[model samples]
Target: MSIPVITLGAVASAFVPGLEQLRGPVTVVRRCEELAELVAACQTGLARAAIIAPGAADLTASLVDRLRFTGVVIIALRDHPPGAADPVVDGIDYVEASVEPAVLAAAVSRAVGRFEAESARPRDSHAYADPLGLPDVMVPQPPDATEEPGTGRIVAVWGPSGAPGRTTVALNMAAELAAAGSSVLLVDADTYGASVGASLGLLDESAGLAQACRIADQGRFDGAALGRIAVSVAVKGGRLRVLTGITRPDGWPELRPAALGKVLEAGRSLAEVTVIDRGFCLEADEELSFDTLAPRRNGAALRCLEAADTVLAIGAADTIGVPRLVKALAELDDAVPTATPRVVFNKVRAAAVGRAPETQLREAWERFGPSVRISAFLPMDHAAADRALLAGTALLETAPASPLRLAIAALADVPAAGDTRRRRPGQRPRNVKFPGIPARLPR
Candidate 1:
């Protein structure tokens, strides 16, 4: 079968000479003003490929977004000058770097062939927004959870060393928010000891964030590509879109800082709340020693802090734990000066454990006052936590009534769910980046 081809509202002078060699049915428009009409006509499903001039002033990002929705291949003129007015975004399949007639035709043929193969297969909801303009496929946003157009929310969960329950807190918090009918995305941003997949019993097979970094290095990442990379977790009573961590610490280099920022931003667009499970250490160096995974430039965890609107500081409830948290709190101040850390003492057992844990924490904070906001307290329930972990489920699902789970759920303040555009004092703008060059390039 032959493929359908299209000309923009006006044919470029550069492409006119070789128009006859283009082997497809063509529809041409008179001028740039009619480009919309051409695009609209293409939506009737005839155009499989679009041939526009590099100098075509009518092309636009929105137009490309629309054509992309229709699953059409965009073939720009090969002779496009280096600084053409209309630059191609990353999603474009092939670019004819030269204006040769045969080369352009070959590129178009390849692009159309790939598009047809994709169209022949089942639809991929994650790769594209549904035809009817429905919410995103993998992580649909709740109708009431709308942001102020382009703004997004960020949530960060941090814990001191010694199994202070960061993942547990982040997972349950995200699940609770999702259950309340808000679209939530849970991200495991911990560079070291990223056990989100293991805690939930997900197979640690693919490197999701690595793939995203590769895409972002090419400057092509968007909401649609994000949905494709994020792994969807099916919670019993809740829905969560998760972007799991790298399988091994060595894989951290693949998770570029800029790409990670963009991925979080994209998650914010698709989800009402983005819950991040961060590494305990906020320092941006790989030399620090850790238990689970080796470091990759060591900036992954700290990057989460810089991006988060609210930072949840978690710590153990025992004697040594309190002092460690106090010290950790001091480090947090230096790392994220713009945001104050909120403290949560996990594994608190007032009955079986000593009553003095809270008192000690309060006293220590009095001397170290104003730096940390000691907020919630979670009691210890070792039996329930162990059972839930063994069953490959969260405490909320395995032991909903457990004191620890209840405490974590209560930490969900109204502001976290109500406000979607809040930002910390020091977070970088959405388009800016920290000091460093990107490490990976797109394949």
Candidate 2:
């Protein structure tokens, strides 16, 4: 039986006549006029492979991944020599447009053969499974012997709405971690409002997180690739690597949950600790209303929370903020049952809760909030915050002596297991305990 193949793009169509001449190895089933038609043809199971031009309309890494998920072997026909300027599309084989018809056929056969061989292999029962239930995606490799255990801990900074300082906490925490001599990768995973690049005084034009997700979706993510995409920011004591988030909200479809998971997996090999600044919403209503395969706007945040080793749930210190945080905590618990977020109240001040705000807030929390203990109370330091924002630098650099900076620095002292770095002499440790926070709230 001849292998059935579909062709798209003008460059690909030019080979149809030649391909049809050599009928034994492969057959041209349909010449699609557009990407949608090609996708539809592949979905109908009429084509085992698709040969598309690199310039096809709306061609993206996400589309390539979707086609591959349907078991369609993709071959890109390039009319020019490969160069640094050429866009790298992962998860697809490339063939020169000038290649002979026989050679093209051979390339398609080889790709299909490899795909079949991989599909037939015995599955590993203990391997990391895709929580999204995606098929044929690459399984992340296990840590090598040289890597220290528990080194690459993912700490996601999440908070309820009303500007509870999620980015502020995430950025400073990452800087503090780096200052302590640990390699850090600070990722802006907030699709709705990504400002890590802007916050650190770096160019926000390139969407580093989205680009990383594209590479990860193709199963090509590695330490070197991560290093290339991440911008290095020099902190006071050490340098921190950062992956900026999407430039626009419409780019959310690029940050699929499955790909984000892979990106986090690869991050373990790149940095000792990965701090993700997450968005506010955790609702999955899109999944309920649309097709199972439709993109969910809040999926990225939920995925990060689920994969985080530690979750820093921040909330503003006020009447409205406290109630919102309480409700959000319940929503988070329902969304990710395994997550135990360290509750943090930002902008804690006398104006918000009246005299001795910490005392009153703690008392009220004990009575009304979830059973989880409050981890940290960041004082309202509008001047320091404004200074840092104006300078486009972390508090560690802009206002090192600010009370807010001191609080974040203290939080970083509670290191991962096996981390024995001692605090500077005379630096007092904050009275915060991590053991009491229950994984699930009481019924």
Candidate 3:
């Protein structure tokens, strides 16, 4: 098969003669001078491989990612020794500037072979069907896809952009799991804005999450090291370990994917249940920090959703919240497409959704997202929130019997016969009745 190729910059002149000799074998279909042209050429399927000078105008990581995503293999001309391509600027095979034309031809052939190998991988395995049997679900693909038959489940709590009370839900879930005698580990993983520690009045001085990431980065992370980083927080009848998030957003780069993955696997090994409280943002740009393999702020959230056995997707319950929730689910369809997330409504009130908000919400969700089922409903309790915030702890510690805590605890015991409402063939579950709010959220 003829491998169609493209070239940019003066490097093309050096390879054109050799490429001429192999014209029938390797076709130089396009000679692009501008980076934009290169992007367009790759995007429009004009070429399958590219040889670019490092000095090509506007050559960026984003462009490389787009090319790679679209099945175009890039070969960057580098000054490095020619054993293998440099991993720094992703999707590019490098050859020394002064390499022989034959050597350059061999490099192009090697890049094509490598590209074919990668292209042949089972990427479609990550695509799952939505509840309605719609084909566009993008679930996070695990590295070692061989899932064990029965392991203690990991539930990642994620919400939309707004403050939909994800930390509140995650804290109480971990606490509930602990009280049930399941060893639980509560992780605060918000890179943009972390409040799990603040919610519990935990200290902000020591960086537990960052420290764990550092140890994990060095390949020395373990359960014992996990204990060293995490702080023991007292709950109703037991204590659970909590790994606080980074002190600031600037520290997000430290939460590298390799490091974070190790921590997650280790958490499951230690705890019967691990509840990771994540941030709202879930953008997955494979080219993020492509040069150094640095972490993006949203990487942790994306990884959490993918790694977890289940996802607890929390959203606001008001009018704005409901519509936002619908849009968020649609976006999630593109992000973690294959994940069947259990949606929870937080801050449900009469002012925003009118009387019998649950009924209105149920119909709206059924209309907008036939496949997304409302799993749990938590009421807005300003007093309970205030008291817990003021006391520097979870609702279970201060307002255990409050409606809010009760609703959250119910969610924590999912699939336990009476705790959850499963969707039947033609209707909502029979035994479950969602708790409602007596008052609305005060201004």
Give the higher-TM-score candidate: 2 or 3.
2
Strongest candidate by TM-score = 2
Expressed as tens digits, the lDDT of each residue in 216-331 for candidate 1 is 54455555666656666655456777777776856666665666787777766767678898877766665424211234445766677788877778888777677788888888
Number of clashing pairs, model 2?
Answer: 0
Ranking by TM-score: 2, 3, 1
Off by over 4 Å in 2: 1-5, 8-37, 40-49, 52-100, 103-151, 285-293, 414-443
Segments in model 1 whose C-alpha atoms lie over 4 Å from true places: 1-150, 286-296, 350-353, 368-370, 414-443
lDDT values of the candidates?
0.62, 0.76, 0.69
Q: Report the lDDT of model 1 for residue 192.
A: 71
RMSD in angstroms, candidate 3? 14.0
Estimate, for each residue in 201-255, the C-alpha lDDT of model 3 and write its tens digit.
6544455777677557544556655655566666656667778888675677767
Candidate 1 displacement at residue 419 in angstroms: 27
Clashing pairs in 1: none
Worst 10 residues of 2 by lDDT: 434-443
